[model samples]
Target: MRADARKNHDHLLAVAGTAIAEQGVDVSLRDVARRADVGLATLLRHFPTREALLDALLRTRFDELTARAGELETSSPSEDALVSWLRDCVACAHEYRGVTALMAAALEDAESALHASCVAMRAAGARLLTRAQAAGTARTDIDGTDLFALVAALAWLSDQTSLAPRADHLFDVVAGAILTSAGNSATGTTAPRPRP
Candidate 1:
């Protein structure tokens, strides 16, 4: 890609990502083109179809998160590291609200975002979980898949409720379930923490 073409491509990707994140994957390509200050022909030239656009959108974000997780992969306390990464993931979740759904929809079109995103997130998450488990901070029984499932579920749930402060509580209640029995024993209760 030439410098000018590369700039246009990057602009389109940014606009498309913002549009999809704000409105959803269902947002039309015209809107993306408008936001990018490009013509529909240009948009289509870069992204042949809706699936192509969404795949690129998701792949960009997945790659970003993978890089972030890699940079943060240190020998820190497992629980702390896991918590840090989860916070980062939550931020990403908020940044791209319907990203999970977009990827799901993309798969129905036989797109590659699903596999690529899954592989990237899985590898990053595995490293975090392994460190957490090693530090005896996370439950040994829970693996990367379990944690990712919990995070995805929580991300979906969080997106549903726009209750601001309540979002953190919602995530904790759902994610806390996987903590070891001795983990939150100090709290002296297995019941769901009452919502704020």
Candidate 2:
């Protein structure tokens, strides 16, 4: 890409990021172009599609979260690494409204623009979960898919106006359920109660 085109692409992405943060993943392409002071054609030239645009915007974040998992894996205890990565993943998913659904869908759709990034992110968390489980800190029943679902669920909860306040507490509740007594003690979480 030429310098000027690259500049425009970066500007459009920056504007799109703010728009998506304020509005959501569903924010209109025209609105993003308008906000960026660019024509729709120019935006399309750079991104081609909304998914492409989002793929570009979110790929970096996904990579960072993946790298963070690797870092935590080496630096933190197994349980701590898993829990910390879960928290970070949830927070990242919550950053852009409506992204959780897209991520969930993308994870299953190999052709989706976001598929690779989402898979890598899930794998990163899965590695952390596996490490913790191997150490007998996390539950043996749940797999990486369950952890990914929990993240989507937590992000969805945060998206709800009515349930937003309870998201954090619920995150702990879910996290506790994923962790065993030893995991709970390490993370300062209590075991979840059995349902009646």
Candidate 3:
């Protein structure tokens, strides 16, 4: 690509990242083009589709998380790494409205634009989970899929306005369940319930 065209592409990505962060992945492509001072045709020329753009945006984060997992393998205890990375996954999903749903669908669809990224993320979390289980810090019965489901559920809860005040506590309670000490006890728990 020519220097000028490369500049335009970078500018579009920067603008789109901000727009998506502020307005969500569902934000208008036209608005992104306008904010980037580029034409719709230019945006399409660069990204082709909304999924393509989201894939680009998510790739860096996924790579970072994967790298972090590798670092934590050497730097932290197995259980600590697993729990910290799970929280990170929830935060990443919460960055965009409706992304938890997107992630859940992407995980099972190998052909989806987000599939490879999701797979990498799951693998990273799986490494931590396996380590934790082997160390007897986390339940051996739970696998990476269960951890992913828990993070996605937490991210979904984060999107609910009614859960604002109690989200943190609920996260603690849910995330704690992976620990062997949580012991399947519901006694004295005040965790919020799903709306019917």
C-alpha local distance difference test of each model = 0.68, 0.89, 0.79
Give the Cα RMSD of candidate 3: 5.3
What would the per-residue lDDT of candidate 1 be over residues 1-196, giving only the tens digit for each residue?
8999889888898888788778876789998998888889999999999878877777767777777777677644555556667766766666677766554444345446457675767679778878766655556776776766666666776677566558777666644554444334422335432222
**Higher TM-score: candidate 2 or 3?**
2
Tens digits of lDDT, candidate 2, 32-125: 9999998999999999999999999999889999999999999998888888899998888888998998998999899998899899999999
Error of 2 at 195 (Å): 14
Superposition-based RMSD of candidate 1 using all C-alpha atoms, in angstroms: 4.9
* All models, RMSD in angstroms: 4.9, 2.4, 5.3
TM-score of 1: 0.79
Of the two candidates 1 and 2, the one with more favorable lDDT, higher being better, is: 2
Candidate 3 stretches greater than 4 Å from native: 1-3, 182-196
lDDT of 3 by residue, 1-196 (tens): 9999888888888898889878888989999999998889989999999998888878777778888888888998776777678777888877777777788888889999889888988898998989877776667777889888898888888878898567677877875667555322322233232222
What TM-score goes with each of the models?
0.79, 0.93, 0.86
Q: Could you tell me which residue pairs clash in candidate 2?
A: none
